[model samples]
Target chain A: MITPSPALPIAVPLVAAAFLAGLRKFLRRWLADLIATATAAANLWLCTALLRASWHSNIVYWFGNWFPRGRMVVGIGFEVDPVGAGLATLACLLTLLGFIYSWRITDSGRDLFQPLMLIFMAAMCGFAMTADLFNLFVFFELMSTAAFALCGLKTHEPAPLQGAFNFAVTNTVGAFLILTGIALVYAVTGALNMAQIGFLLGSRHDLLVIAAAAFLCSGFLIKAAIAPFHFWLPDAHSVAPTPVCVLFSGLMVELGAFAVLRMTSVMFGQSLLQPHSAFRATLLLLGSLTVVWGGLMCFAEHHLKRVLAFSTISHGGAMLLGVAIGTPAAITGWLTYLFAHAMAKAGLFFTAGILLHRLQSMSEPQLFKRGRPLRFTAVLWLLGGIALAALPPFGLSNGEDLIESATHAHAIHLWVTLMFFFTSAMTGAAVFRVGMRVFFGLGDAGPADRAAKIDEAPDGPEEQHHIPARMFLPAALCIALSAAPAYIPGFGRWFFNAAHRFLAQSLYIARIYAQPVHYVLPPAPHSDLGSTLMHGAIAVVCALLLASWAVFHLALPRGFRGATHLEGPMFPLRKLQSGHPGDYVVWCMVGFVLLGGCLFLLP
Target chain B: MNQIVHIFPYLVAGWVFLCGLYGIATSRHLVHTVISLAVVQTSTYVLLLNIGFRTGGAAPVFADISPGITTVDPIVQALMLTDVVVEATVMALLLAMVVKAYEKAGTLSPDDLRLMRG
Candidate 1:
């Protein structure tokens, strides 16, 4: 068998997207869908090949075969490590699943949907694999451009237009911030390749480096939907179509966290990883804040999609914590968590899409007592919630175990554990509460709010009485496969070795120069499964209790129930999410200023 | 004055970026907001170009110049070119959305676009 090149994952999707886009007028919808699906599958296969090839060594493929001149890298390179290729594979996998789920829906723009999805997939693959900073920016723009257009796909309503608009503006600004940082880094190092930059910037802790770190981190953090810069996420996710939401929440946002990890490890390794680095603390604080804010909003909102969106933000924070910890074990946990979250979150969104298709609504109250017929889907939804809570036997719990064990010696390990517990419980409770209210009719009327009243356009050409087999298949597979990794014996040990290489800046630099270095694999860290299970059990119980309270609180004594109402306290916080583009811009500025100040002003 | 000249472009880039942000935070019309974003993007071009500039250096071309001659950095110029195209495409997409928003809601004021508020 011929070995697949690293560029095929990016090239196949790009060419297919252009082909589908160019012949859009001539091609039938089904034909276009077939081409897109085939392209995604091809990309996934190629990425898997690269992932396996890169299992032990980082594979660097230079574009145009332009080899580095002695010490200088003159050509753009795709440095494919297992983690990067694995992310690209996940992006392709999610795109393929989304296409399958969306096959029945007669998209608003007949041929526009598949091409954009292909382009988005292509961009994500490129973003995950590129070692060139400028190329990364280019792919970032490509991804955002495709996403913005896709968000506004439902043009019949003004909400999607508004959502897409805010998403475009904020993310565009973030991209620009990243570009500025790239400029600074190029100025200092005269290089754009991450490995070259790292080599040139060895042990430097200058102001330019600090400023560049701030700018890059700020930009990607915004994309990651870290709080204070996260105002645009809910608005965008809640308004976009369901399959599109799957991509947005599943892999796109998490790629931001992935970028931060790659950038810090490759380019700013020596400076940022030194002891007493405030950058680490700043990230931890931001992650904690995102966790609390997202968890609270996830439970408070009644719109099913918005609840899922906020839960994404919360889980995104947990991933950021793993990145911030900056250990091989922690990153291994991050990768596992990302896989589980992507699968489980996509499953949850699919369930939401099912609800929308059947009941013609996404609000819990509007959908209350109406989803009793979807008994199988309810089971899937409940399982999805349990997996999301990181309960034992689920893949997410295994990921949490690794992260918790990795942080066991840190000063703020307890705080990290608490944040993880809070996020899982609150987000899981929101899902459980929605499931009980809509599926089982176990709850009193859900609370009414302005957010729940927002207009939503349902997916598919028309509503159906019977659930389609295609729709059920993807959600079931996603939830089932989400737990598969945890059950795979010895997967953790293998993943830890891959992650250790991912964090080795010197090893990457050596690879780029075509020089071999002696490298030793550290002993695979042991996961404290017993403690992890205990924590997971507590979180699951808390989720159940919280869901029960949200549903049955009205039956309690008057004073107790009066105190139980939590939405009142959240009004001010929610008010910050005014959905105005200007307000979001203001928050972006505030976040940038604070991030810059914290990163640059600290001693 | 030499030092001042060297730093002037950097200051201007920073100033332009902040000004564009201010325009976005205060803008009432969607058109104005898009323009503000364009302004923000322009600062990147300025920054990238300024970083590549070398005083008294020739353009990075070898048609008539000696191989060892001092020349401005060509890579940053190439980067800026791509950045400009990306900025233009983003602006066009934003404007398209603005036109759609205007037709659907019959208003362009940010305040009136409160249909998604909490």
Candidate 2:
């Protein structure tokens, strides 16, 4: 049996990225596409090999081959478990799809886009596979910086620039926090390897240890866009190029959640499973709030991309809810949701981009114009929306079913489950509204706007046929692959088993807290004291109060107007958007200091 | 005195970092922002190296045949070296982006740019 090398997937892209950067100056128009496509294809091949090998064997590569040097274990390493390999394959596949999707978009400077994108892919792969905490930090920075640059690719546009600036500021602060935490850990344990750190810190909980954990977890939470830190995400995703936006919303942001899971599993696995666990409760609360908030924001959005962006956040919240459940079934649900969301969201973005290309606008109402062809794009959007809404026969449905089953026994879990269902329904409604506007609204056909919108000139036949087949092929492929997993028995099991291993393997909290502890509580008896008379009198008083309140409020002119007259003060907070760089910097600094202080000072 | 010597490097690193943060806060130009980021990154490198340094340790370079002789922690130094390269790459990319922004906007002053307001 031939086992795959773990380093190739990371090394190939790093080398290719460097090569592309050097050759970018002299490369022709199509050269960038060729290089990016080839590199991504190579990464995909390597990932496939790794996946096949990982099915039967775990691969580990010690850096510099220095692992057996006097039993010191000083060198860093790469540990490619089944889960990491699977995620790496998915990342590479999506990157290749993104490359293909952007093949026709020559407006973005090709020279810069391809290399940065390859670097981003390599960083993601490294982040998934690296065993060292410091290496993880490096890859985290790499992915983030690349993402920031990609967001600002349309640097002339005010929205993308602003979005990129905010993203950079927040993530840089996150990076600093992560680095500080790493420094603290290293100071305490003198180890950089993750497994080594776990072994060293075992059963030795200290103030410094908890402080470091909080700092690290907070940084990851910021990256994951779990609630308040998500303020930067909608703007960033909506303003970035459509394909890049898809990757960012669908895959890049989930890396944060993945980081949290990985770190917690390694560092605080045993501590997380205690009865009435505060950490689990906190996770559940944040996840629930994010779901509701993101759903409401999505419902309020009118722009096409921003709706999807908020929906992505809502889905992320759902995945985190599953993680908080801390069961094998819940982990499987989380992974399945991740897989389905990536495919569905990417396809949705691609379809939206295609519509925008044809209609020359992303506004919901503008899509109804007569000149735009709505049949194909609208159908694709609907399919993607169904998958996103967790309708039956799709991968999301299976995941949602598992999540429901896992959470139905507990009241708090049931409440979170209800929020997930509600938020998904709201997302479905938003998508339906957009679809209705696009397909059935008043048609606007002033003139033949094709010439103005399409970049193809009349004389150049080559340029006229520029909807390039490569662009849509990968999206269709992703959509098909997403649906295929549900039908294939073993494929879902592959991911399910990987997730099971992640939650149940060595260092899991379940191993430590497996024993059931008995708790004694004071018992109370049911009583029916003075029920008949009290019920009759309360019912009569309630009917009277309801009648009086309705007569006063419901029948008045103010009630009919429904607070429409007070629109001026309804959004007074809009004045806070100063658009000044100095103001933004100050706000960022304030947030950083407050968060840092809270992390260190809080008991 | 021993404690002061042990703490001095941290104070220097912190001072540099604070100066960089101040520069970033006050800077109106994109170039200045990039410069401030560089300064901040340099401070991190300083802190990393300082933490790795021992009181009587020699440089990390190999000189003699002895394997266990006093030598500095090479791991942090190597990590810092890689970090420097990454920082340089990020700085270059940021500068390039700033140039592109200037080409489009005709100004480096972020205050005047307001095309993407919600």
Interface RMSD of each: 0.8, 6.3
Clashes of each: 0, 0
**lDDT value for model 2:** 0.67
Candidate 1 per-residue lDDT over residues B54-78, each given as its tens digit? 8888999889998988999999889
Per-residue lDDT of candidate 2, residues B1-118 (tens digit): 9899877877887788778778776778978877876777777777777768876888877865377777777887877777778777777876776777777678877666543233
Which is the leading candidate under lDDT? 1
Per-residue CA lDDT of model 2 for A1-603, tens digit only, reads 566578888889888888888987888758778888899998998988887776643466787875724323477787676677878888888888888877746365447788878888888888988878999999999998999888887654545666676577666656766776786677677788776676667756566776577668767777888765566676677667776777787788888888888887776665434434555666776788778777766655556777788888888888888877867667777787788888888888887776666555665544554323556666777677666666655566666666666665677765865766755665665565566557544222111111112121111123222345665676667666667656776655676667765654352322222223232222211112233123323322432332233223334566453222211123232233334444444554554454445444534
Q: Each prediction's DockQ?
A: 0.86, 0.35
Question: Which residue runs does candidate 2 get wrong by more than 4 Å?
Answer: A24-32, A68-71, A155-159, A271-276, A368-372, A442-469, A504-603, B1-50, B62-72, B106-111, B114-117
Q: What TM-score would you give candidate 1 relative to the actual structure?
A: 0.98
CAPRI quality band, candidate 1: high
Q: What is the TM-score of chain B alone in each candidate?
A: 0.94, 0.91
